[model samples]
Target: MPVVLSLNVAQKTAPADHARVGATGIDKRPVDGPLRVSPPGAKGTAGSGVAGDSIADWNAHGGDYQAVYGYAREDLDWWQSELGTELGAGQFGENLTTQGIDHTNALVGEHWRIGTALLEVTGPRIPCRTFAEFLGQRGWVKRFTQAARPGAYFRVLEEGLVGPGDEITVVHRPGHDVTVELFFRAVTTEAALLPRLLAAGDSVPPEVVELVHRRSAVELDS
Candidate 1:
């Protein structure tokens, strides 16, 4: 049984990364007690939950498909060793820091029941310029890409409260071979794998499915 090691929310602050020119809510910090969890709503709409946790970039973040993000403590440990620094929970801007779960390997559409909320894995967190700037590491984006240990993003299925130490149980897993790592690879570096994403059915994000079909069509035409 996986568990939430810490529940975190973003701190509204001036843009610390090149990804945004205005305020960015990427500097997440651990919160005490239970935190409300729900859909961030559709794009162009404000994200739900705590007031300050709102998505700073509507064009690239937020929406029902990416309501919450999770990162594994194991992966953070790995990065700590590489960077020779200590990383607290939520350093990666994840809402939940989890323990004892293979986050990168979890299958898309896998459901995790935490507290009273049900969340389904949507996809992997792709590193962006903002994340690179947040860490202040040169070539961080390329390094992160090469590592390919992207954490997972989930969509809220049942709105409820979640807090640290909540037990995480996999209540459902869609029958599919498309793990988060595989999907990340398909999106980032493996064009051939795009066609294979169809095996995951609707488990894949609608936009991702459309992108896969578009890429597949272009390949066929060429």
Candidate 2:
């Protein structure tokens, strides 16, 4: 029984500087059901554009998915142990910290209720260079990729509102043998497992499916 341990939201207030690789300022705030997303504006805040309903945008620029941010139950402990601070000291970036659910094992298409908001786990995040830069550690992205427990991303199926301390309950879990962790490993390392993952089609997203197909094709051609 997974539950939402905490919730957090932040706004980037300043441009990146030499000393800082990401937004220079972050303002944590509260939000309710029906999250909104628009194209970034001149002021840097997201403007009313297309609603952010895609995994690519949620994971882009810095793993900025609001839904997945709810899975950061471990961040607080990790930050305190390693960085000697809490999540809001401008070191670790995440929103909606959670607990109880094994996010890596969440099946794609599975839906969960976080307070009044409905979120569907769509896919696992693909780690990128920005992750490495954020930690000031070279190759950190590769290390995280290799670890293969990339957290889940969600789509707002029934928009409402969510906030810190919201409870999360699984509403649906598709039958799939492949876990998000396994899918990530297959994609980044043991590509031979791609076929098996794809066979569990219900649990994998189209982009992941295409990526596997492309890699397998290349391997066969080579």
Candidate 3:
């Protein structure tokens, strides 16, 4: 059974040496109380703008399709071994640090009933320059990408309050073989896997669906 190991939230803060010149909410810290969760907005406009949470980069951080991010403690343990450093909850900027669920094998469109909220697994977190900078790690983006264990992002289907220790119940799963890891691979280093994403249909977010179609078309044309 999956469970929320920790809940984290952060406020926008001024840029650090590595972060860009603007507020960044990636420095999330563990919270002791229940935090409200909701869908920020549709697609490109969604964010974690619910109470007590913030999204610094409205252009990139939040929207309907990425209302919350979840990373597995198991995966974090793996990174801890490789990086030789202690990583606390939300170190990866995830709102919920989870345990038990295999994020890599989480099927796209899987729905989780956490506390009073319903969330749908949308995709995997792709490594970005901002994320790399947050870690202040040399070649962090390349390293994380090669590791290929990026955690999951979710869209809020039903809003509610959630806290650490909340049980995560899988309420539904779309009948697709595409897992979060597979989708990430298709969009990143494995272009050859693009076409298979279509089998998941509308379970995948529109933007990525479009990407897959475009890439598949190019592959065929070439």
Candidate-wise lDDT, in order: 0.84, 0.54, 0.84
- The Cα error of candidate 2 at residue 156, in Å, is 2.1
Sort by lDDT, best first: 3, 1, 2
TM-score-wise, the better of 1 and 2 is 1
Name the best candidate (by lDDT): 3
User: Model 3, residue 181: what's the lDDT?
Assistant: 90
Cα lDDT tens digits, model 3, 1-222, are: 789999988865556655454567888889886888888887555458355776777666678778899999999999999999989999999999999988899898899999999988888888877788888798998899888999999888899988999999998988779999999898889988888888877767788888877876887899
Query: Higher-TM-score candidate among 1 and 3?
Result: 1
Superposition error at 187 for model 3 (Å): 1.0
Worst 10 residues of 2 by lDDT: 41-50
> Each prediction's TM-score against the native?
0.94, 0.69, 0.93
List ranges where model 2 is wrong by over 4 Å: 17-68, 75-92, 200-203
Count of residue pairs whose backbone atoms collide, per candidate: 0, 10, 5
Give all candidate RMSDs, comma-separated.
1.6, 5.7, 1.7
lDDT of 1 by residue, 82-154 (tens): 9999999999988899999998989998999998899989899888888888888899888988898999988
